[model samples]
Target: MQYLKRYLLICIAFICILLGIIGIVLPLLPTTPFFILALACFARSSQRFHQQLLNSPYVGPILADWEADKRIDKQRKKQIMLMIVCSFAVSIWLLQAQFHLQLLLIVIMFILLFCIKRIAEK
Candidate 1:
């Protein structure tokens, strides 16, 4: 049972790492969250994989900082917020939604942005 769980975790970690790599080239698919998940799974299942992930130039620093402090830098936070806003705006504009729904989405996005900004300031 333990072995099975480890195998499953390794598989999921590999898949997430692959997705994170793909997300690097695909603007619509954000990479950080997937990389974070991969790190978690690798930490639990395979030390070799975890070390390799930490050695990755693109993702290593973010993972290291997150692991050490549970915090992201202000610049990264701003970048992430901008990406989220632009993506949401594009989605809202492209969808043929009702005015009220669009307004609601904008409001939600504003709230999220505000929260993220507050966190980043800290």
Candidate 2:
């Protein structure tokens, strides 16, 4: 049972990591949350995998900041916010015929901004 649980967690962790990678290209999705989830799973299931994740160049620093203080640095926060705005703006503009979709995108963008704002700065 314990082994099965560990295997399940490891699988989930890898899936989350893949989503995090995809989130890098898809602005509507967020990367940090997925990466963080993966990190949490790895921490619980496998120390080696957790350390390997921490050693990743692209994701390590962000996770390290989150782990240390549960907050992102001001600069990184600004960058994320900027990316969200730009990507959402493009998406909203591209879907001109769909007013409802545009509105939904706007709402999602604002919600994302709000969530980012609420995260305490490190």
Candidate 3:
């Protein structure tokens, strides 16, 4: 059972890391969330994998800072929020759904923006 759990975590971590790499080239796909997941899973399942992730140039510093401080810097928070908003806006505009769907998306985006703003402020 323990081995199974570890195997699953490693698999998930690998998949997340792959997705994170893909997200680097795809503007719409998020990078941080997947890297974070990979970090977490690797931390639990494999020290070597965790070290490799921590040594990664693109995401290593952010992960290190997050692990050490449990918080993202203000500048990074703002940048992440901007990216999220822009991506959401693009998604909303591209959708050919009904008015209700647009309204719902706007509301959800607003709520998410508000939450991100609050987190960034803190």
**Clash tally, candidates in order:** 0, 0, 0
- C-alpha lDDT of candidate 2 relative to the true structure: 0.93
Give candidate 1 regions above 4 Å deviation: 18-30, 96-122
lDDT (Cα, tens digit) per residue for candidate 1, span 43-106:
9999999989888887898888876776889888988788778876876686655788677777
User: At residue 117, what lDDT does model 2 achieve?
Assistant: 94
Q: At residue 93, what lDDT does model 2 achieve?
A: 96
Looking at model 1, residue 34 earns an lDDT score of: 85
Cα RMSD of predicted structure 1:
3.5
Clashing pairs in 1: none
TM-score of 2: 0.95
Q: Candidate 2 lDDT, tens digit per residue, 15-46?
A: 99999889888878888889999999999999
Best by lDDT: 2
lDDT of every predicted structure (CA atoms): 0.80, 0.93, 0.80
Task: List candidate 3 segments past 4 Å from native.
Answer: 21-30, 118-122
Error of 1 at 121 (Å): 6.8
User: Which wins on lDDT, candidate 1 or candidate 2?
Assistant: 2
Off by over 4 Å in 2: none
Ordered by TM-score, highest first, the candidates read 2, 3, 1
